[model samples]
Target: MDEIRKNPDIVYTDKSGNRNYGYLSLGCDELSVLGGRSPLQVYSDFMRSFRDEFSNLLGETIMEIQVGMGPAGELRYPSYPESNGTWKFPGIGEFQCYDKYMLLSLKAAADQAGTVGT
Candidate 1:
């Protein structure tokens, strides 16, 4: 994870100016070795790790988390909140996940925002 965070090539800037920090770039086949844990569990673990390692970037709290997954596959039908996208985790802000491509775009929208210099 540390290595992925340090790679400049992984940072993508969309046309709308949204900076997407790609955390994982793995295919489902490659990721299937996790040994039977559901996709929801995998996402939860990732979130926990991100919160632990990058708490400073997340600000006071995680207000919400949005996760997207492919329609059909091992990860399909993964368990998650059903709040119509308004889910909130007070104190923490927002986090968006990309499903087709395994990438967690961390949008650090706090007073302190910038790349972690290598």
Candidate 2:
């Protein structure tokens, strides 16, 4: 354990020939140095690192949407309500149907522009 803690890159072999890899923790200074500027800056750096590490493999970009309550406690909802009248619950929560449509429109535009995959 001591050896593994000292050198995390090292691989150990037991008497039974089973191999074990070491574990390491990241320090704040190391994170700042490697990530550069801030953690968000690391996103662009990932492309270069991934390309260099996996030159022979193909890579693609992906975009995702995250839905959550806003600072004012407002929640997002689907563009259109269910026609079956099942979603007509009262006082359940605030729903912003337009936001979903906006996101869908943006996604459609991105797809048409070839920025998003099929």
Candidate 3:
């Protein structure tokens, strides 16, 4: 929350120009700017620590570990924000790529794939 408060661009912006704070958007890309780590990096570190600390419980006490990405730990975009009243149940969620970071990433991908025009 503090990060978003400091850098509003971290949040997802819809086509209608509304900022959705339902979860951190592509802001995860610029986390390093604020002396923070990316979400994937943080998760990787956590798995490493868990493996190191619970080496003995891998197949006994700890049977398995479930991992997820994105909001609510689910690998999905924050398309619907009920709190903002811009979306509702049963409605198709909006795309979450209006942020600068996401746009740059998309452009890079397109360029790499030769999909972007010169």
Best by TM-score: 3
TM-score each candidate.
Answer: 0.25, 0.20, 0.71
Candidate 3 clashes between residue pairs 3 or more apart in a chain or in different chains: none
Highest-lDDT candidate: 3
lDDT digits (tens) for residues 1-118 of candidate 2: 4444443322222223232332111122123323134323454576578667766554443244243442234443332223324236453532231222234555777898989733
Off by over 4 Å in 1: 1-34, 60-67, 71-118
Regarding TM-score, does 1 or 3 come out ahead?
3
Stretches of candidate 2 off by over 4 Å are 1-36, 59-118
Candidate 1, 36: how far from true, in Å?
3.4
Residues 1-118, candidate 3: write the lDDT tens digits.
7776887667788877788776566646545634477755766788899899999999999998987765577877788877788888889888877776666677788899989632
Residue-wise lDDT of candidate 1 within 1-118, one digit each (tens)? 3433444233223323233332333323233324454334677888799788978767456566555544332333222222433334443323333333223323332224665521
Q: What is the lDDT of residue 14 in candidate 2?
A: 28
Provide the overall lDDT of each model, using Cα atoms, as 2-decimal numbers: 0.40, 0.37, 0.74
